[model samples]
Target: MELVSGLFLSKRIVYKNGTPVPLSVITKSFEELFNIKLGDCYKKHESVISRKPTKLTEFLDELRKFIIEERENKGYR
Candidate 1:
């Protein structure tokens, strides 16, 4: 993934707690890892908001959806 505006430029995926979750999971598993808060959100602009301690699986799922939608937006078959 690419960085839109903050320190969360990239993330990796791996397993944890006998669960195959993305490395992003660490954002919550170890909040201290990034000096971020769980479920804490930031308002970038009046109409824009960003998230910290983001969940990995959620990120990937959304990323996939975005990519697909982008493709469709660009008239992909």
Candidate 2:
């Protein structure tokens, strides 16, 4: 028997400015925040989606924290 799973992929990032950030930018930000090679975050997200059931909000919240931490670490004003 084949087990089917629902894979969650972020279609887009909806910013507070009511703008839809492009996938390219989201991917790039993730890379910068995590200090990972370009495209690594996308691969990791895909792997997580395949392994578990994750909510979109939960994922975004975690990503938000990472972004904030990265900025603080970089001393971004």
Candidate 3:
């Protein structure tokens, strides 16, 4: 949820015409793809923003770490 919210907020994911996608649309697509309901995506994003110790991008950071670890494990620079 946090990852999706971050992407939505950044506007990095867009339509072919370069229009910013709506948050609800992105969230709905994610829900359908993941087969799980994310209730009140806006509220969840607010909670992520209000995280303690200024770790707002916790999930994104974790994802980066996982990708780096995977690359290292595969002997790829």
Candidate 4:
């Protein structure tokens, strides 16, 4: 949820028409795709922004670590 929120906030993604995607649409797509109910994405985004140390990117940091480790293990570096 944090990652999705970050992506939305960053404006790194958009519709083909070059318009920003709504947060609700993004969150809803993620929920349906993952088959997981994410209650109150706005609150989750608030928590993510308030996270200490990582400062709104805690989940992304963890994801980067895991990806790096996997790539190293697979000799993809």
Q: Please, what is the whole-model Cα lDDT of each candidate in the order they appear?
A: 0.44, 0.52, 0.88, 0.83
Backbone clashes counted, model 3: 0
Give each model a TM-score: 0.29, 0.33, 0.82, 0.81
Mark the regions of model 3 whose C-alpha exceeds 4 Å error after superposition.
Answer: none
Model 1 lDDT per residue over 17-46, tens place: 544443344445545665655443222211
Best by lDDT: 3
**1 or 2, greater by lDDT:** 2
Which candidate achieves the best TM-score against the true structure? 3
> Which residue pairs in candidate 4 collide?
none
What tens-digit string does per-residue lDDT give for candidate 2 at 1-77? 00011111233356788576554566676557778665454555555455544553455567789999999999996
Q: Which stretches of candidate 4 lie over 4 Å from their true place?
A: none
Tell how far residue 10 is off in model 1, in angstroms. Answer: 15
Clashing pairs in 3: none
**Candidate 4 overall Cα lDDT vs. reference?**
0.83
**Model 1 segments more than 4 A misplaced:** 1-56
Clashing pairs in 2: none
lDDT score, candidate 1, position 64: 89
Candidate 3 TM-score, C-alpha based: 0.82
Q: Please, what are the lDDT tens digits per residue for candidate 4 over residues 9-45?
A: 9887789999988887888899999999988888877
